[model samples]
Target: MFNEIEAIIGKAKKNKNYTQRGAVPSEEIADLESQLKIVLPKDYKYFIKHYGYCFWFGGVVSGLVGDNKRYEKLCCAIRKTKYYHDFYDHDSSYLSVPQQGLVIGKWAGGGYYFLFSQESERAGEVGLFLTETYGQEVSKFNSFTDYLSFLVTGTPDPEPVDVDYDRIMDIIED
Candidate 1:
């Protein structure tokens, strides 16, 4: 799965900002899970285990690696999750992120992409949340693989449907 993503990214003309670090050790992944108290999705774990952090196409896919000054401005999965936790606290009305949600990616334009952990039925599924809206999900995929595929390629797993505020609220309320 990750190989396919690598191939796609390899085709792109990398700019100076492109950074794709190497694989992380299993112990490091375990430690991160323990520290964050979150179980990353299997596909994401596989990607990080073999491909570390990635900054491509002007977006970022978080990972456990990257502690250098170069990545100071970058937010790993844990940091991004904590950042949103504060955002949710300060603006609960505009942030509808699930308690089980962990941000896995972010677009340069401020759109956050997150996945619900194993605790929720939404596990592995990727949901897009925009702060500009009432934290309503702008788009969602059946899985992280699908989301990554769409992010790397122009194709979406299934065409993205704009999730309305009412529908999103209904899901969250349940």
Candidate 2:
């Protein structure tokens, strides 16, 4: 799984600067695999392996894009906890609860974004979340252990958006 995730990340980094219009780049399959540190389900691997650069937000915007249904199913299996619900309410901008087991949220500083895999845990097994960010920088998480450590102990990292609304409207009017 880790190997698959690494492959996805590698591809994303290679094309980080390339964008279409002004939207987030569709993450490369390699980059996604790298971040996940786990082999995606067979259906996902097949889609990504075959699709090449034409998958994800770059080509389609639906949750069904690239075998996300598998993850969605996993989310459905988990019971929503107070912590999860509260996180959703507090971060309304980034939280979407059309279903269960999946919790998406933007980090505080806006530098990073996350999609969590929610499920009931007994002791050592923890929920998994995929975090991605934009810009020229790349943040590192050596392993799932490292990623979880940051989630539990780190402060919120938010990116402040600085847009001149009035000026932008004037340009649009012209």
Candidate 3:
């Protein structure tokens, strides 16, 4: 998974639209998990740890570092999650805000925000929250990697790459 993500990052790096904000330290990621009160999916954690936040393809993947206050302040997952939670609570007509979910990122100036589920059965999976429908009839992804691939290349599953779980575990364990 890391290798495939690396390839995606490499491709994005060459594009003018890609702008890496910064990489987050492990501590900050942990702090974010604490703030969100959920253990984030492993793949999402890896992205945050190694790449931090970024603006690429057509959206911003936020992190602890808010480089541009005006933009990042609104895009921040923590804030978005909290706000949406309260929002949906007040208005039940709209699809309920994802339960135990975090707003990972968005596309097209917040036209859509990706919600990462922390629920036991759906952990690591992401669902699109189209602002227009309030997330009804939303698209879904198997994992963070798939969601990211869609954001980067307009596909859920990109070119296949061999994955050695042992090696990946070793790298991530450190």
Candidate 4:
């Protein structure tokens, strides 16, 4: 297990009742991989296996799903918005490799943290893209755990009290 993931699990265990978004079956994961035509990072796979398909701290961090029709996945959100591509496609410096990873964690001001399938030193290694900022390029987050830690430190705001996780996937880019 990734040490960061262990820390994330530990922190969540210490902070709350540990409610999972829900379990994603192995077959669905495999189907997602097949559809994406890329191997998912191992840490992410472990995360899905243990943490399930929902974001942590309510809806702060997004999770990848095996099937979009059945559940919300990172790609599902990305596919809905061409904003990411429209804003960053011409900037080679920004690494517009939407095909290379999943948008697992979103940030304020249209920023997002993506897990790279390529151009990363390790599986589950992530980088941030600030869509609203100029020349922001990428902010490295060593691992998914690190991204979770940032969110944890910022606050443990449980999934928005009024937001329905089931229906929230449609508006991730909004």
Best model number under TM-score: 1
| lDDT (Cα, tens digit) per residue for candidate 1, span 1-174 | 667666655743254466767778899888777877778788878877876767764667777655655663474777787777677658646655677757877755666788877667888888887765666677788877777667666567544557576745664676
- Report the lDDT of model 3 for residue 169: 51
Writing each residue's lDDT as its tens digit, candidate 2 over 13-103 gives: 3443421112212464445444433333332233235432122222110122233344332221122222344444564233332222222
lDDT of all the models against the reference?
0.70, 0.31, 0.65, 0.56
Per-residue error (Å), model 4, residue 56: 5.3
The 10-residue segment with the lowest total lDDT in model 2: 53-62
Q: Count clashing residue pairs per candidate.
A: 0, 24, 0, 1
Q: Work out candidate 3's RMSD over C-alphas.
A: 12.1
Give the least accurate 10-residue stretch of model 4, judged by summed lDDT: 155-164
RMSD for each model, in Å, please?
4.2, 17.7, 12.1, 10.3
Weakest ten-residue segment in model 1 by summed lDDT: 8-17
- Kindly list the per-residue Cα lDDT of model 3 for residues 73-92, writing each as its tens digit: 64467776777667656854
Candidates in order, TM-scores: namely 0.79, 0.21, 0.76, 0.61
Candidate that would win on lDDT: 1
Residue pair clashes in candidate 4: 58-159
Model 3 lDDT at residue 17: 63
